[model samples]
Target: MPDTEQLTTTTPNVQTDAPSLPNLEQESWQQLASAADSEADPFKTLVVATCTNTGAGARMVVLRQVDVIRKYLWFHTDARSEKVIQLEAFPTATLLFWDDKQQRQLRLVVETRLHTDDYVADDQWHTLGLGSRKIYLSERKPGSEQPAPYQGFPEQLGENLPTKEESEAGRKNFAVIECRTLSMEYLHLSRKGQTRALFQYEPESKQVWLAP
Candidate 1:
């Protein structure tokens, strides 16, 4: 049999050297910014967790935009959705991102602001194609009980995408969620060893390695 220990050490994904704190922090933000621009990136889909009146809520949302310099991120949602309401009531939320290929996970604490019927919303709305705009055209509110299984958009459209004129109706329901990152926790899993670090952006800037 082959030597398993030697093979593990030779794996391409295994880290050969310890990275400096500053380098690790820079790497984390670079990956985040890249994910926002690339749809194929695994980190493009992230989970947003918010505090509810009773407990908490979590859901997967696509990464729409990222500003590494300012440490801001953006995602879109329906203005009438439960998440929007929850965010309005509790502006603080957590964003969780994981990239299986890189074996990295990022947890970000952020302060959220809703942009509806504003230029921010308008710009994001214009960027979305008809296919994405269709969801916002639903007459019924999101999370509402339905008598039968219903697609979010009009049934008549079926698989067809809405025209720009038709999609305009959805603008009223579309909303942009702007998140200002307060802190970020990074974790990397590897057969060789695990690495963890924390970066704070608010109150005071700080970075520290944590026991993994």
Candidate 2:
């Protein structure tokens, strides 16, 4: 096989073709896009870092959709989640994604814009299957009460999935995280090689495919 690090010898020769965007960025995003889907990898989530009223915190969330062409991403969460509250108070948030198989890490700085009401929330809600929709069935709001050794689910039959009747109520729980990407940095470690690159999309424009 050709050395991917040496794009001049690789099949795609992407480095020579696009001097701005690194081939590593292109490859990683391609992997992410290919892996991102409701069925393919439902739990393929990123650890989102959102600032709190006092400090920083992070939580894992399922990856929703990726727009490579326009450079954007989306994720779903409960309306009452602490992350949501923090995001509303502080729109500046950062997303961290790690691909274990690829040994790659991506850091993205974005601005959050809630997608509620109108067709936005409805469209996403309609696409969710019954199994995934179950998350919206929680009786108490997320991060709300604390009782004995609780796993955060209401006491009931247990195996709970959103029913047709509860779907409407779920509409209020639905939230879309719109990430207006400001910059994306990529780092990859491999047995054969390592690579690092930083991409800037605001204030000034720059991209580099460098030695790691």
Candidate 3:
């Protein structure tokens, strides 16, 4: 029988040679920044889950920014989206990240705050490219149905980029969701065994390994 006690790797920035709870947490923060900047990083996109009247709602969003010291995360969304409404009502959410290359999953519990017309959103908006800004220019609110299947953006524009003046309309719909992480749960799967740990940041800081 093949032994389930060894593993090999073909990815970068994944270390299992000396894995520890603190080391794993440190690597997660570093990878968050790398993921945002590097297109090849699998951690660039995360699943954000929010509370809904029915149950739970989840969607994939690009990881835009990371604040390591403050343990904050940032993602952009349309101000009129259902997720925004859900967050405004619940304030607390979970961010789930899975790295297929690393065979690991990181779940973060966070308190969310919306920034629509504030400086935070304004600053981030200025950094966005015209392509990204155009997404917010839809005539109808996000998730709204159309009579004859309307494209999200104006069909007249087609593949052509919108002018700076034309893109200004999107600013009103643009928002930044700032997430302050309260706790992080890390799980790593390996052929030999599995490793799991929990890091608590709120109320008091603590770290403990868990059985996987």
The lDDT leader among the candidates is 1
TM-score of each: 0.92, 0.80, 0.90
Regions of model 3 farther than 4 Å from truth: 1-18
On residues 52-152, what C-alpha lDDT tens digit does candidate 1 reach at each position? 98999999999999999999999999999999999999999999999888899999999999999899999999899888999999999999999999899
RMSD for each of the candidates: 7.5, 8.1, 7.9
Model number with the top TM-score: 1
Candidate 2 backbone collisions, by pair: none
Q: Ten residues in a row with the worst lDDT in model 2?
A: 12-21
Give per-residue CA lDDT, model 2, range 79-171, as digits (tens).
Answer: 878888899999989988776766878888888888877676778888787766767766678877666555444456267654677656667
User: In candidate 3, what residue range of length 10 has the lowest lDDT sum?
Assistant: 9-18
Per model, how many backbone clashes are there? 0, 0, 0
lDDT of 2: 0.75
Q: Which 10 consecutive residues of model 1 have the lowest summed lDDT? A: 6-15
Which pairs of residues collide in model 1? none
Between candidates 1 and 3, which one is better according to lDDT?
A: 1
lDDT of 3 by residue, 1-212 (tens): 99998888676333457477788899988888788777678888999999998999999999999999899999999999999999999999999999998998999999999999889999999989899989989888998877888778989899988999999989999999999999999988988677788999997899988777
Order candidates by TM-score, high to low: 1, 3, 2
